[model samples]
Target: MADTQRTSERINFVHQDEIWKAHVKVEKDSAEVWPRKWGFLTEAYKEFERDSVKLKEVKVTPSHHLATRPLTPPEKYTNVGPSPPVPQTTQALIGWRSAHSRLQLEQHGQVHHGRRSFLKVLGWPRDACS
Candidate 1:
């Protein structure tokens, strides 16, 4: 008997006849500590799209985070309709303490302070701080 192999096909949700290909150029900066890699150039190719209809491409550099992009109104058409509603989220406050601190507090019924002060308060000999 001969072994059979099955080929897998990509299932794209958008069944549009158009196809898009993106090429990216990445650059790594030399650093004595931590080096960060970022994409410098990005080129997009669209199949079946007219060459005259150029898509707006934004090149994000490593320094992009340092400055904010200036907002410009659309030159061709006016933006209409009400803005989308902001998402509502709930925040929670969480805290943690060391087990050793908890143990000392449980055993001595005391809170945060130096070891010497804590011992001295418990009638134990206090050592030189030096």
Candidate 2:
């Protein structure tokens, strides 16, 4: 009985192995004629190559402002007589403050709406316009 059971299990294993091998063969044959598979792969590779070349061309060049050489002060510095004091109008001051506030809010990921922090403070209600 033990030998008979072993022989049956071996046969089942062989059958499963044969089925797997046949499946692999079928996949290999089908893949050979897959529409534009190779062409698509080659085109994808070419696109990657093109992008790589473009990226290389766009690599950041060092700017003069960031150069390692020591910066020398300007040769001539003239101080013109005290300039006349400029008057600040309320509206201009308010506009400047608003602009500054907006910049600060933007830095903190908050939207600015010209004196309306109601919508911004409440996590910017979903329906709010961008």
Candidate 3:
């Protein structure tokens, strides 16, 4: 009951803030700062990414790239190469089964395999999902 009330209050507060924001006048300074803010954020993200342990510098191999002899994109901007392949439904099912098996290892209850894991993968609580 308390949790429900808190959720409702949080939702109400969010809606109220949205309503106020919609009516509030935009300042020229706020518009001007957007590009500067994004530039700073992009630079910071690049710096952090460079320093991250997971980031590895790769030397490009000569054979790695395809020469654009025939289907070469114009000197100007153009969509290059092939689009990504569509994923099969079984791929998702496999992921769900794996995650559910992991969850089953943690808990006492019997996991309903794909059904329970489908909810887990979709970010739904097991009890609420049912």
Candidate 4:
């Protein structure tokens, strides 16, 4: 039928027009714009490098005291053995106790005892007290 043919032709024409408009828009937005932007960034970085060199020349001096102090060797009597492996449950308990002790110290200016003593004071399970 001619009516169906005319409707199909109209639909095809609209679709082709949309595709042409998209192509035109893409062409108008330069394909080289991204490369040009990167070139500008590189030029800016070179300028920054030049400025930094000039600043260092003006401000840097000998005897700037940048060398680190030599580390003192440990005492001969100090124990240097590998630390004992802590169980996961013990580690978690210790971490909790340490955090709690720090908070108590901050609030009261002192904790009653070290980690083990603090755990005992908190009445944590006997196993965790160790």
Q: Can you list the residue pairs that collide in candidate 4?
A: none
RMSD (CA, Å), each prediction? 32.9, 14.1, 26.2, 15.2
Q: 1 or 2: which has the higher TM-score?
A: 2
Q: Write the per-residue lDDT of candidate 3 for residues 52-129, one digit (tens) a residue.
A: 735466555567356545665575675344433444786665545335444334556755655457777889887965
Model 3: ten consecutive residues of lowest lDDT: 78-87
Q: Sorted by TM-score, highest first, which candidate order results? A: 2, 4, 3, 1
Models sorted by lDDT, best on top: 2, 4, 3, 1
lDDT, candidate 1, equals: 0.41
lDDT of 2 by residue, 1-130 (tens): 6646775454577777899999999999888777555658877899999999999899698999988986655554633344333438766655453354433435567665677666777878857966
Give each model's whole-structure lDDT.
0.41, 0.69, 0.62, 0.67
Per-prediction TM-score to the true structure, in the order listed: 0.10, 0.32, 0.19, 0.25
Off by over 4 Å in 2: 1-10, 35-38, 61-130
What global local distance difference test value does model 4 have?
0.67
Backbone clashes in model 2, listed as residue pairs: none
Model 4 Cα displacement at 36 (Å)? 15
Q: Tell how far residue 17 is off in model 3, in angstroms.
A: 14
Which candidate has the highest TM-score of all? Answer: 2
